[model samples]
Target: MSLFSRRKLSEYEPNDHQYQLNKLNFKVTKLEDRIDNLENDWECASQGESFQLANGIDAKEAANRVEKAAQKALPNELKKAFDEINSAVKNEQQSIRLWQYKLGIVNGEPQWVRIYHIAALSRELKKYGYETKLDSNDSDGRFSSLKVSWEGKETSDISKIDPAKKYILPLEDTECEITDSVTGKAISHEVAYACPRDDKWEIIYERKIYSDAVVVPGKNIISAPNWVKSIEPIEAD
Candidate 1:
């Protein structure tokens, strides 16, 4: 029997409640999991899916997909970083310029040409143009501005990205038991690395493909034996 009964699963019915529960009742799960551990587990593993941190790439990819649905987009800082180096190279006009011009470095263009490029792109960004502008007042170069668009109707000024999915990637190793089909023997494989699955917001490991690394999304991934920091061979001690 459950030690706590705030509401049963049936209470959250044929609506948006399941996802909402993941958001609203997620924290409570830590405590619930602990209590269930101390007693008979009321939180059944038979449920569709449990939780883990979605890998970082998975989260970032999710954000990028959303941005693309809006239109072409570029993070402002990406451009600023390019500028800081390009400008540094330009300001070093000391004696390198004569030679740089000879070598056709940066196409021998002056600062104005670069700035013009940014301005022009921003002006027509809504029509599938992209551009960046540096903030002279900001020495750190963090305040660079970016404009990107492809549809000529809507443009995005996205300075930040947030993952839409609930999973956060696990920081440490995940442990599991694997039964060898050939021998019908239960063995253990510790996950050393994990990556995004082809499906949306899913994760996989590079199991068996490389001898040193154990894959994350194998047959037994759902039945976690115990998540731990080290999956060292059991006989190591």
Candidate 2:
């Protein structure tokens, strides 16, 4: 006979502690398998083999393509504006001497006009007897309001304000028309200054009287093939 009789199969059973231990061992084995799989994946990725996102795209390559697309989507005008600003900074131009502000977006494009440029425009406008007001908060670097008035008529529309148009070319001999202040009639006068004012020349006649300095919208006085040229960036102290 055996030294100890073998227990019947129905009578054999695992204790509570043994049962819990078996469950814990099974979970640990599963966790170790997952860690091994992660390490293998990292090794494959480092070797540039079988390392693509679920969408069949390499993560780094996808990021680079997205960045390029974003850069290409920038408008040409915006790009040119940035280049001009960068060149000004590199050359230490006076236009960028003072703090600059991006007033706002116009026609879905950003306005890169600086404070110096606005001040120059204001001075020129004042020379023509136009009242210019710059209502801006420098703290935020954006114009809170801008107003331009001529003869009691005011316009706050930025679309109507053209920096290039405000430029007064030195063509005193040019012939153009001017409106009489009292008679409200068009009078011919020698153009003291030719301004590019929205598809025409805003003519300033030789002032014979105090009120004669008014600007009159007239036909193109410049007939030279290269009459229109790029405006130089304003430089002022």
The all-Cα superposition gives candidate 1 an RMSD in Å to the true structure of: 27.5
Error of 2 at 189 (Å): 52
Deviation from native of the Cα of residue 146 in model 2, angstroms: 27
Candidate 2 structure quality by residue, lDDT tens digits, 1-237? 443544543244556667899999999999999999899999998988876447687678888775544333322222233344346535654232222355567799887654333443344434433466766666554544334344342211222324434323333123445679999898754434334445543334444331323332222222311111212211111
What TM-score would each prediction reach against the true structure?
Answer: 0.16, 0.25
State in Å the error of residue 166, model 1. Answer: 44
Predicted model with the maximum TM-score? 2
Each prediction's whole-model lDDT (CA):
0.33, 0.43
For model 1, the superposed segments whose C-alpha errors exceed 4 Å read 1-43, 46-74, 92-237
Q: Which regions in candidate 2 have their CA more than 4 angstroms from the true location? A: 1-15, 35-48, 52-63, 76-237
